[model samples]
Target: MKKIAVVAANGRVANKVITEAVSRGFDVTGFGRKENNTKAQHYVQKDLFDLTSEDLKGFDAVVDAFGAWTEETLPQHSTSLKHLCDILSGTDTRLLIVGGAGSLYVNKEHTATVMEGPDFPDAFKPLASAMGKALGELRERKDVKWTYISPAGDFQADGERTGKYLLGGEELTLNDRGESVISYADYAIAMVDEIEKGNHIQQRISVVRA
Candidate 1:
């Protein structure tokens, strides 16, 4: 079985992803800041900043579900990502990030990103900008095996898992209903599929419900 470690495993998306991965028979270890009843093979209580290479040596992949909401904590996005990259710098372990949709381009021409668009909520700009900056730095790293998965515009926490989704490049994806959304459960399917196939390595991909 593949060994997978999910950081921030208690999160809504990460929790569903862990359940999906475990259901598929992957050996998963959930890492969190404190005691958590996560559905995984094992649980580790540690801070993201304190993770070392030796502690994560055998995992096939590490899912980064880290998020920062407040203004002061927003910069932690870049810091946390860089810290993970440093630890897994030379190893073969893949870093699968649950990324923000804000950074996704609004069109194929790459005219403007969602964060740059006028309709984006002002409340979310700081968070999106921070994640975008981290993504920018992530693209510069050639040593680490990373795949950033950006969910659709409406990342519904209460959304259902229909086991179907469409994958796209950097542009935002809109369905026939003119909706850009994907549930945490369905996104997990796409994430695990990428883990199994290893296609689109070192790339940023988006997922929207089919």
Candidate 2:
């Protein structure tokens, strides 16, 4: 079975990803700040900032579900991600990152408007900006087999997994309602599918329900 390491596996999205990965027969090991009461094959309680690849050795891939983003935390977040990628460089192990939608382009010419709208939250702007920069850095690296997965503009906690979605490259996706949205379950499925197939290497892709 494929052994996968999941970093920052305590969130709702990470939990769903772990569940899907395990259901697909992958040996899922999760690392996070606190131990979740999940039935994952293995769980390791460790802070993302303190753990190294040596701690994650022998895994086929690393799922960075650790949504590390904040204006004040940007420096540490950038350093930690770079460090993890460097440690896993040149190995068969891949890195699958769950990224923010802010880095995606809404149209052929317009960038994603995560922070410009009236409804945008002030608290989330810094984190979204940081994620955009991090995605840029990851796109420039050649040694690390990485894939950045972004969700749709209307991502929420209550959508159902209909087992359907649209895929795009660095471009924002929208549904029939002229909005973009994805369930945590479907997002996890997409990420695991990419991880297992070694798809979308060194690229940023977005997903939304079809």
Give lDDT tens digits, candidate 1, residues 123-204. 9898899999999999999999999999999998989889999998899998888889999899999999988988877999
**Which number leads on lDDT?**
1
Query: What ranges in model 2 sit over 4 Å off?
Result: 69-71, 109-121
Using alpha carbons, what is the TM-score of model 2?
A: 0.90
Candidate 1 accuracy as TM-score? 0.98
Clashing pairs in 2: none
Best candidate (score: TM-score): 1
TM-score of each: 0.98, 0.90
Model 2 per-residue lDDT tens digits across residues 76-136: 5567678778888888788988888766775677554555556678777787778777777
Q: Model 1 — which ten-residue stretch has the worst lDDT?
A: 32-41
